[model samples]
Target: MKALFIPGNSPYPIFSHAPLATAVRNAGHQVLMGGIEWVLPNIASVGLPPVKISPVSMEEVGAFMGAMPEDPLDQLKAVGRVYAEIALDSLERLLDLADHWRPDLVVGGGMFYTAPLLAHQLSIPSVRLEWDRIDARMYDPGAESVLAPLLAELGLDRVPEPDLWLDVCPPSLRPADPVPARTMRWIPGNPQRPLEPWMYTKGDRPRVYITAGTRLFSGDALRDMARSIAGLGVEVVVGAPENVAAELRDQLPDVRIGWVPLDVLAPTCDVIMHHGGGGTDMTALNAGVPQLVAHPEYPTEATRRITEFGAALLVDSGGQEAVTEACRKLLDDSSYRERARSLAREFTELPPPAEIVADLEQLVAARA
Candidate 1:
């Protein structure tokens, strides 16, 4: 079978969809990925096969982000508008690509509007790989006005729903939202990199992994958090780019620093601290490590869910004292670790991505 995977024009979505593409390929299906040019490198970095879609300029995305309203619901609406605009911009090119490729099925990340649009045009089944809790605000009635022109152009009165929704969040961690979904095991898609010797070595003290993801690096705050945590008589490992690591080394001479893959470093950690990205949060859960998330911006659903599950703590104030206190609780409390392990077990017991290949095939056959 030929499968086309469409990731949104963002690094997060591209990385998130990589594992599913790999699973499909491993199941003896041909998989091809589509996204804007900017995110194609990230897809290729993970060694996934990709076919470039119509490019959306960075300036356009940047302007949309910059112009987003302060209210969270408003922000989601703004994002929906941007996605609709990008989808409209790329519609013709995407149609042409689909005509040439003639894929049996279409798969896309949850926020990627183009995949469903293209699939609707081709009259083929499409699946949305859930990235986080489905925000109803993103699908607000107001978005109809913002998207009406494009929807009219495509002969669609509204955005068509995907045939399937693939969710990776464990049942206990999922929100009470009513979206019917098929649960897939959370597989960390952090890019594969060389492992450092220290990653495998057990330290004398509890190990803590600290990261702020590739984007949204908190410069001084992260250094301060690392410094405070280092003084707690624990081993501090900072995952960052080489230049950032060098800068952090100046602030934390005793801390280990480098770009170690989260999949390798997470298992060694007793506690993980990060900026509350969905990918990082899921990685910590998969590793059975308790988390301390400091998100001054909108806290992701994963952050909230993990906290609700008692496996993690959220620090929204963005203060050093809050971060320090949360780290202390994560280190000193045994309940957090126990809950984390329980969540990890739940994730482990779910059917692996490869196991879902037959289900996807059935869905496609039914569509045919």
Candidate 2:
């Protein structure tokens, strides 16, 4: 069987889908991942062969994010429309590839709107892989609004749902209202660097790993938080791109700053402080490390759940002080680590990615 994986034009979406793509390929199925030029390197880095679709520039994605409203629901709606636009922009090239490639199944990241539309057009089964524990179906109404005209042109009323949903969120941390989904264990797909002894092994003092995610952060705020956290007698490690790491290193001489792999460093840490990106959040969750999220955006279902579950803390309003305080609380409290470890256990117990390859094959066969 041949499977086509479509990731949104960014690194994180591709990171979430890499484990499953690799799984399907290992199971002797042909796999191909498609995206704009920007994400081709990312796809290649994850050991998947990349097929270039149409272009959606980073500037466009930045503009869409910049235009998002303050309200969470409004933001969700806006994101939905933005992705719908991405689908429309890329669908022509995608269809052209589908005609040539003729994949038996389409596997897509949650926000890759092209997945369902392509599957629908080709009459193939589509599988949607959720990055974390949020209600992805919330984007449907907004997506449908933008896609309505396009659907009419195609002689369809609505975009069809994927035949399957692979949920990576642990059962305990799942949102109260979740779309019907099959559970899959979360796997860390972070990019790797040469491992140092300290990265894989724990030190004597409490270790805190801080990252700003792939995009968007305040250097001054991160520097302050790292310095302040260090003052409390804990080891602080910051993972970032080289340019940012150079800047951060100039500001803080004592802390470790570089591109440290989260999968290797996470287990050695007592706490992880990051911007509330889903990939980073899940990576920490998988490591069973308590979290301190200091993003400006309002809490989503995943963040709210972990915070409520006592495995993490949120710093929405306060600047560095609030973040430092949250980090302190997470580090000082034993309960937080206990809860995080418990959730990690739950996450590990869910089905592995390889188990789903057979299921996907069955879905394709059933359709035939």
How do the residues 111-188 of candidate 1 rate in per-residue lDDT, one tens digit apiece?
677788888888888998876443433544545676688778878877888898888877887777647878888677
Off-target runs (Cα >4 Å) in candidate 1 are 57-71, 132-143, 213-217
Relative to the true structure, candidate 1 reaches a TM of 0.91
Per-residue error (Å), model 1, residue 334: 0.5
State each model's CA lDDT, in order: 0.78, 0.84
User: Over the stretch 42-152, how does candidate 2's per-residue lDDT look in tens digits?
Assistant: 899999999888666677767767777878888878888877888888888888887788999998888778898899889999999987765666787778888888899
Model 1, C-alpha of 113: deviation from truth (Å): 0.7
State, as a TM-score between 0 and 1, how close model 2 is to the true structure. Answer: 0.94
Clashing pairs in 2: none
What candidate 2 gets wrong by more than 4 Å, as runs, is 59-74, 213-217
Top candidate on lDDT is 2
The TM-score values for the models, in the order shown, are: 0.91, 0.94
Q: After superposition, how far is residue 205 of candidate 1 from its true place, in Å?
A: 1.2
Cα lDDT for residue 205, candidate 1: 91
